[model samples]
Target: MKKNKMSFETSFWTGLAEGNPFREVDAFFAFAYLDYYKQNLSEMVIYSRKTKVYKQDNPSDVFVLYTAFNFFLKVCYGLQKKSKKWKVKDSLCCETVFHLTSLTQEEYENPFIVFQKAFGENTLEEFELFLCQIVELSLSPHAGDPDAELTTPYIHLIKMLDAGELIRERGVEKIRKTDQMDPVA
Candidate 1:
């Protein structure tokens, strides 16, 4: 008899409500919002940019998710520097350095894993889930202009995305039409 290994979705995240977007992990995980969540990616992006739109949210432990996924290779040092430059807190800087040293200098860990363990992020799975939350906020009509959206995390995610440092590090060859409007660009 073969026993199946439980996934984080079925494990770490439990007691999901019916019709929850997370039930279709691919929607967020594979960027298949259209198929799974009935969401249009471009619309979501557009919705996210409208920072003034307000949303009425019901109280619930679970928050919906949508994500713009990007990660840099071997970026722990950059995280460290960010802490020093006051882009992030000092504790986060120390944590980044700690993970950098312990994961790379000592264990020779994989670059991808190292970034996940660094100060600002969690394990790869948790981080991916976090990205989904970003996507969720971007899709809401309430996400109109600043201080409008019902969700909070997406606001921070938008600010981070606006920074474009990661996008720059990823070395994008083509900028999206939506991105052309970036204040920094």
Candidate 2:
């Protein structure tokens, strides 16, 4: 994934200034996923910095990010419920960053609906690959789902990462500064 010439915020500002926040989340998700996740980063510090201070205050934007991220997770891994209490987990926030870059929703929910089916019976690592695949597919010009057919790859790459994956490489030291806090159920 190559870095886009412009940040998602560039396009977002124009749309937001015009009162169109519909596809911002979708575009942001695409942009961030490509730049931050797919391509290797400089020590992962760049993305790490972008994350810690970021917050999603808008309900609509929250809905979009969570819906998309959760959809991706579901598609790749399997159907799972999300904890209502938010945490600073990279697995969660990485996807959220994708949504934060832009604003707006696609009119049809076919992509999301199609992915929901593919999510069944997948392991976490396998789900990661599926996620990579989904981003690749979505970026392609020929990509789209009218009927939203769900197909199975039958590949299992879901290596459930421990705290290491949750914290991210950059946050490793930061974790030592804090104590474990029970997650809100």
Candidate 3:
């Protein structure tokens, strides 16, 4: 999907500074799902980076990005559970996500600071979207596979996020210098 003029950090803080992180996520979803993105698959999305021709970014990319950050909410929820720093409350609208809250604002935007302190900034990004998909596929019909409404992928995802701590314990730039990750794909 196309990036917005507003950086994610800005949009994230606008809502989060008010104690409702979900509002930020929903704002992104709203901005990305605008009418322009609702065009036919063949329609031009934006100018290509290397050429004048318009870019036909798949509409599905928005969904992928949405799912990715949506999963982030859960990750924060799970992390907060153990750290007990944010004092979060459950989301009544959708149990899958928890709206993380914080009273103080540090110069740096590190809601996951507790984990970061213990594990380095490895969790600055998501664990692995590809690996998660493969594992879920191999296991087949996991918790929320139309059942575990079933299951909480967020908690499951947190389990993997914790692995970053283990990886950082060994001390490296990141997990395998492994980047280009995240999402339900």
Candidate 3 segments whose C-alpha is farther than 4 A from its true place: 1-58, 61-85, 88-155, 158-185
Q: Model 1: per-residue lDDT, tens digit, 34-108?
A: 223223333344545665321334312213332223221112223333322222111212234433322334222
Please state every model's RMSD to the true fold in angstroms.
Answer: 18.1, 19.0, 19.1
Give candidate 2 misplaced runs (Cα > 4 Å): 1-67, 70-120, 142-150, 153-185
What is the per-residue lDDT of model 3 for residues 58-104, given as tens digits with 9 covering 90 to 100? 44444444354444443334444343333223223432222222111
**What's the CA RMSD of model 3 in angstroms?**
19.1
lDDT of 3 at 157: 34
Error of 2 at 132 (Å): 1.4
Model 1 per-residue lDDT at 159: 26
True-structure lDDT of candidate 2 = 0.30
